[model samples]
Target chain A: MSLKNTEAVVLSQLRLGEADRIITFLSPQLGKFKGVVKGGRSLRCKMLASTMPLTQVAVWFVEKRTSGLHLISQCDIINPFRTLKENLHKLVSGLYLTELVEVATWEVEPDEGLFELLLWGLGSLAAGERLQAVLRIFEIRLAVLLGYEPQLSFCLGCEKELAGRESYYFSFAKGGVICAKCRAGARGCKISLGSVNFLRQALRFQQEKLGRLTLTAASSKELQQILPAYLSYHLERKINSLRFLNLLNVRC
Target chain B: MLYTESLAKLVAELKRMPGIGNKSAERLALYILGLPKDEAGKLAQAILQLKERIFYCSRCGNITEVDPCTICQSPARDAGILCVVEWPNDLLAIEKTRGFRGHYHVLMGAISPKTNIGPEALRIKELQARVSSQQVREIILATSPTLEGEATAMYLYEVLKPLGRITHGGRIGVCR
Candidate 1:
């Protein structure tokens, strides 16, 4: 049961004892796993290419019987994600995707469909799609995958059949939108009608079709405010990377 | 468990050091005991002295004993060209190469979101103040090539671009 051979995306790596490195990988079959690469820090290390932030690699490792780091016997880079390294925007997107995968999934839990989502996220990012839009999609999809899909129906207060053609108040506490009549002193941010539709479309959009779907600036801004609030409320903590990305948006 | 109380204390303190395991720490504690009394005392004094004397330069954020680091105080270095680095050690590395003649601004760390480090956490405001105070023509953004480093460079570039009609972007000579 310790032996492993699968395609994995290298998430993060940290230095271990002198010449070794402990690499975190997200594999389709294994979900997330950590293993040791002996002599990985040396100059002539052939497995060097396999451990970059978002690289797709073929890795072979033997898991220990006890709860300890597995021994990585062999690894080869299947896809280097060269574009992710070359373009600064793509690189940040890549790092964001890696961090999302790292936090969303548990180690060796075989997270159902998370590996596929990660692959799609990285592939779309490297292909030069809109950076903010790609992240929005990834964030929404990740939340859905983890079974915390935000309620996108009628207002929590009025419970009326709301038309999706106007702006509505989204409350983190009520878990969804608040009607205009009931929005008196609502403790939440406003979500545009377009963003609500975009979110619905994103939830159902296929991975291959994400590249064709465009995210307008208004929609992006609304999603930027609403999605993070939803995630923080449901996940019970704010993600640091989201804050960093928001800072970039403010400055850029 | 068999060691004397003082020896045990030394080993525990030594074990707190990075890359020092229990065995290496024990060996270091024993080694220190064998050293001359004056030398051992000197080692303890040196560690305490470093903590007391070395401080960050308020303007540039580099480690220094003086108020402003030597690089910030030197007149020979070009004030128009600022070289931003992630850490003090990076400044030392560039200094060792003997190729650059610009003043340095250490960010203390790069933009690492996973670690909860952002522009607000870094010396971004100080860097901005320096940019405004000096007649800088072209900033040499010299953060490392890692993801966080590049992100920090780009973050600075985007923030600095709107302030003036100056050149922007990092990776040496790719100004706009």
Candidate 2:
């Protein structure tokens, strides 16, 4: 069987046999992959460096002509995400992002948008962007890519265009904005337009340009309150890793 | 026209995934067919490799190719301390912290009467044997903060109390 070469991000790794490892990766070209790195568990093996969580690497693997686990022939590290590994808070946030991506995207499906978003998110986290803001943006963008993009332009119920209103409620259940007129009996938290605009920009902005947009302390906090409910509302359950990110005392 | 045997099989497999539904599965199946051959081949290979290469560690029950896993083999780690977890993923969560300096024991699953998974269904007996045979001082029960996890921890506590000290390990402790 011929070996296939590709670039990938190590999403997760598990030991396979005595010396082998089952490496799960998110690749730019191939999407999500789980391959076996022979002798990865041994100290002398160089594959260990490439088969780590969030490590970007160029990899070569052989797929048997028929069908079986691909054998990871070699891997060269691209970026080890040193800052992410060094800081506890950063590491958890990074893991949270990985988990989010794993859950949001389909296995083996080449989602260039989702893959790029993940790479950008990891870079942003490594570059020390505000953790909360990064996560909020990540969630908003993920929702957009997955086709749950919020109707930030208008009241989802009435289709009335929303301006800088005093207060508004985000309907996680309805999957969009609810103007005050429709929020009386809505099943979501009330947020200010400042927070709503921030949410809107998070969805609309390019990753590199995300740095230019800023959130006030209040808007940031309001976003903290809204995004999770918005995600859980659409996803139908709270992401388990999100709790770890929230519980840690890292200021965004 | 689309409700053929192949489409049905694709839907069945897609639906087996954690959160995908029938509609989503159908969409995914169609998407898969639309992909370029190489892309589709890579996807298929990834799934096949995960099942082919990934297996639970015989010693700790964590997913690893090796017998004792990297964490278990590290001489720098404190062998005297063994952190018991409900699943391999929990072991990964603990490992990501790089805080714990010890070994691990994966139970493979928790004791849930509701799920009909009893103590014998888990690696509890192996865990007990490991504690007794090894120079172990503490067993940190790092299970999920759930009903099943709590029950499993309690059961372990009862079984291990006589063997060693039943100390509260902290948030990173033995009991949940």
Candidate 3:
């Protein structure tokens, strides 16, 4: 196997036997992959910050031609995102982003948009942007890229445009907005029409200037419930890190 | 697939064990078959006996054959100072050193958001009860220095702060 290199965002690391660790990372060039970082868990390990989840690192590894764990030789930190870990809420939200990325995509398949989004999301969090807004954008954009994007432009049931400032039902099962007439006994939460419009605009917002668009407390609360529940419905389970994020009282 | 019914059953059973993959389970099953019949019987009996004997201590959540566990019932232990640890293995490590005379409260695990484990799933409630009921004045948080461990310590401090002194006791990492 030849030495391969990629700029990756750390997703998670599980401790292996004693000093070894199995690091899951997402790369712009290589998608998601697990690499064995020898001595990564040791007290003397210098590569600790590089392997920390949510950090960006330039990694060199011996890629196995067969489908097995890669041997990571060197991983240098690109952006540690250390500030994100200082606060409990930010740490869980940052982890939520990586967990979303890890589960949304398959292994060894590159998606440049998702990779860039991951970097931008972590940077926003580390730079002290509001947690709820960053998380909402990250979740929606992730679903869009992964082909589970929730329907917000129009009502899925009535086949009419979702209009005005009234509240509408956003169904996780139906994957879109439901008009009041068609929303009777729907299996989803009632989201404000304003929140739906905001979600749509936020999705189209340029990644570089995401933090500029401030969300109101009400809109943030609505999107926080709608987007995650929808994503969890598609993924067939709750996002584990999100519950912890909620408990730390940093949620929308 | 195995050649015999019993071998197949053995492989299936061994595969259920932690860290035993299908291949490893098969290897272990074959190894067991190669052993003398009495030795194989002894191994099976040992596993059964282990399950019947070992249980979680009700007081601290540590794995023990006794209900309160030896440390909880020990007259030598200083009950006024409690050391809250993340896991039973952590309690064992602390005991191996024989440096601490205080009682322990095993959390079973830390508050790891990535793993969906919050304060609710841990033994923090029992720790709170111990503090309110017992003379737990000086509480030492002996969790790991990992982010999840530190987060757990912080949460514990919040819950126990009103009750007693709270401090962390893990080896210093590269980060403060």
Candidate 4:
């Protein structure tokens, strides 16, 4: 067994027994791993709040070789993103971010960039940034970070530059754009050129400069139409949080 | 090591239980095998009766042998004050304290978007109906301090705010 200490964001947690929980985390160094926390479910346990989903913490855990489930020894809360928990929309969005991270990545494959993207996304939401822009930026950037970057520059069908198209069909299977001429009977979501340009900018922006780029309401609507469906298609599973997020969006 | 088919089947069934591993399941199976015939029969009968008889209290969502549950039907408990909890166990925990005399509403689960659970999945609608129909004066959000718990509480607070005065019991556990 090896004791490892790393900073992580809680992705999700499940109850283990009477007073224990299995916490899934995404760490900059450790990637994704599940660790059992003794007394984690106890109401009075000091680690109760620290071990919650979406909270960031520095955790020390023992990596058990036999079971492949680590035993978490200590966790110190970094930023609980307490604000996100207060608002349902923000909370759902934050959970969606974590769920994306949880489902998109594999275990123990550390990617510092992906970890930073998650932290940045959560921080932006908690800081009360524009919800739609934050979400759209996060979705595009995350897709790029995970190497599923959408083909925004050119038409997949005719290999033509897609700079001045009125609109294009985003092909989920091809992970790129299909021009109007090439989209005959092809299954894809219709996206406006403005939305396409915004996504390209989102992909090209520096991580630190992401906040400076705000999405227009029109582009926001268009990207929202395609990004999640694209990601879900590539990920090959229904994103559990999307339905809840959609419900909230419709209500508001 | 190989066990007889019957013993192996029993062990496998027992191992399916939460917190029960191979060793504990085997030990429990052997212990059950060693029990007196009538004692073993009684144990099996009890399990059967539990499944057959016990059900959720329709009014408060607590597990009970009756429809409305004793607490909901109790004359001593104050119906005007409702304590909202994430699960039935939280209600039991509060009952063990015996300090509060209010009725309880068990949500059955909390809102965790990661798990695809939302406010709609919970008993928030029933809670609203109860508040609207009854003369409820105060709602104590006795959810846990965890993210899902807090989220559930906040969502309930938003839904139940215009109806009555809401008391936020941010921490509902044994701790202060």
Question: Which candidate's TM-score is highest?
Answer: 4
Whichever of 1 and 3 has more lDDT, that candidate is 3
- Candidate 1, what DockQ? 0.42
Q: Top model by lDDT, which number? A: 4
Whole-model lDDT for model 4 versus the true structure? 0.86
Q: Which order, best to worst by TM-score?
A: 4, 1, 3, 2
The top-ranked prediction according to DockQ is 4
DockQ of candidate 2 (2 decimals)? 0.03
Please list all clashing residue pairs in model 3, or write none if there are none.
Answer: none
A112-142 in candidate 3: lDDT tens per residue?
A: 9999999988888888758788888888888
The whole-model lDDT of each prediction reads 0.80, 0.76, 0.82, 0.86
Determine which window of 10 residues in candidate 2 chain A has minimal summed lDDT.
Answer: A243-252
Each candidate's DockQ: 0.42, 0.03, 0.38, 0.59
What tens digits encode model 2's per-residue C-alpha lDDT throughout A31-95? Answer: 88778887887767877667777788899999754544688899999998877765546666777
| Candidate 4 residue lDDT tens string, B1-176 | 59999999999999999889999999999999999999999999999999999999989999999888999999998898889998999999999998999899999999877777878889989988988888877777888777777777767766766664434544222111
Interface RMSD of each: 2.4, 13.0, 2.7, 1.9
Model 1 lDDT tens row, B1-176: 78999999989999888779999999999999999999999999999999999999987888999988888889998877788889999999899999999888899988877677878888999888878787777677888755567678777876676656544333442222
Candidate 1: docking tier: acceptable
How far does residue A181 in candidate 4 sit from its true spot (Å)?
A: 1.7
Off by over 4 Å in 3: A15-19, A39-49, A148-162, A173-175, A182-188, A250-252, B1-54, B65-67, B164-176
**Which docking category, incorrect, acceptable, medium or high, applies to candidate 3?**
acceptable
Tens-place lDDT per residue, model 2, B1-176, is 66889988999999988658789999999999899999999999999999998887777888886767777787899888899998888888898998989899999887543234657789988998888788887778787653356556666775676785545553244421
**DockQ: which is higher, 1 or 4?**
4
**Candidate 4 chain A, poorest ten consecutive residues by summed lDDT:** A159-168
iRMSD (Å) of candidate 2? Answer: 13.0
